[model samples]
Target: MSVFTEAEIEYLRSQLLARLATVGVDGRPGVKPVGFLVDFATDEFVIGGYVGSGMAASKKFRDVEANPDVALVVDDVANIDPWTPRGIEIRGRAEAHTTGGAEIGERLGSAFAFDAAWIRVSPRRIVSWGIEGSSFEFSARDVASLPTSKGV
Candidate 1:
């Protein structure tokens, strides 16, 4: 079974950009808008891009190597009249992988071909609101009990 609820999975699939928060070795927090892929087969979030100098040279990837803990947020304002905001926040351990970007790129289509590298996040905790039925609904859960596939 997937750790994400059906609604959560659907929300993730519908979104293309997410903010990845990582703590550098110096204790500074860094956040960047990145292209992401929901890999249901591995039940993890795959973050990478074909922009800039590539994922391997990025500071976020280096930060993950130094401090694996990270947070990823995918949110948006659903409406303006009543002010509805919905999103999912994930706290987890991230691992930097040197390869396997081609496969992820294929899954995400031609626009995103991370071919160089990517980061895999194994979610330990999840908090989400305004995703299910109404903006009033909120849920949080610890998914540490689930198995992790880091190197795989």
Candidate 2:
């Protein structure tokens, strides 16, 4: 089953960056702009950064380690004159992994190093608006039940 409609999937695929939010052990919140890929097969969002470098030592990774709960927002204004705003908000649990020689690195393209670390987020809830007059929310179960498709 597909978690998103074809149009929604197309919108996601067309966009390159999203804002990822995580909470730290000290109860502080952090948000960063990250390049992401939507894995239609797993219905998850994937992001990678160089490991054993400044990225690995960054606070965002630390925050994810301390609190797996997170949120990601991908949005843009379609127009300025009439004011059409559209985007999707994803609330989910994130799992961090070392991407050494992992296929995920390749999927992320040449921008990411081969040994980069990555985070895969499994969404629990998704809310979307402003695409084709569509506005709705879906739970994980609801998403899982939708028919699956071949591409992102």
Candidate 3:
């Protein structure tokens, strides 16, 4: 079973961008908007860009190597008339990978393909709001507490 609910997964798949927060070696926090993909096979959020010489040198990649803690937020306004907003916040450990972009590329298709380094996040906690198709209150949970949470 997956850590995320079906509705959450659907929301995740519908969004292409997320705000990734990481900590620098000097103990500073940094957040940036990045293109992200959910790899259900491994149950991780993959963050990276197109295959390029500078990908490995990016700040986010460096931050992950120095510190594994990370948070990712994907959200948007769903409606104007109702003033509806929805989003998911995931806090987890992240690992920097120097390879494994080819598989991600296949899933992204040729136009947005990548063969460069990437970062994978294994969520330990999750918070969501406004996507349950009912109420707008936020719900938070510790993913590790769940029986099938991949023990994050």
Q: What lDDT does each candidate get?
A: 0.84, 0.73, 0.81
**Tens-digit per-residue lDDT, 1-152, candidate 2:** 66777877999988988999999999988899987888777788887765455555667777887899899999998888677778888888887665442476676453656345667787777877885573333323324432322232
Clashing pairs in 3: none
Report the C-alpha lDDT of model 3 over 22-53, residue by residue, as the tens digit: 99999999998988888776567877777774
Candidate rank order under lDDT: 1, 3, 2
Worst 10 residues of 3 by lDDT: 143-152
Maximum-lDDT candidate: 1
Candidate 2 — worst ten consecutive residues by lDDT sum?
Answer: 143-152
For model 1, the run of ten residues with the poorest summed lDDT: 143-152
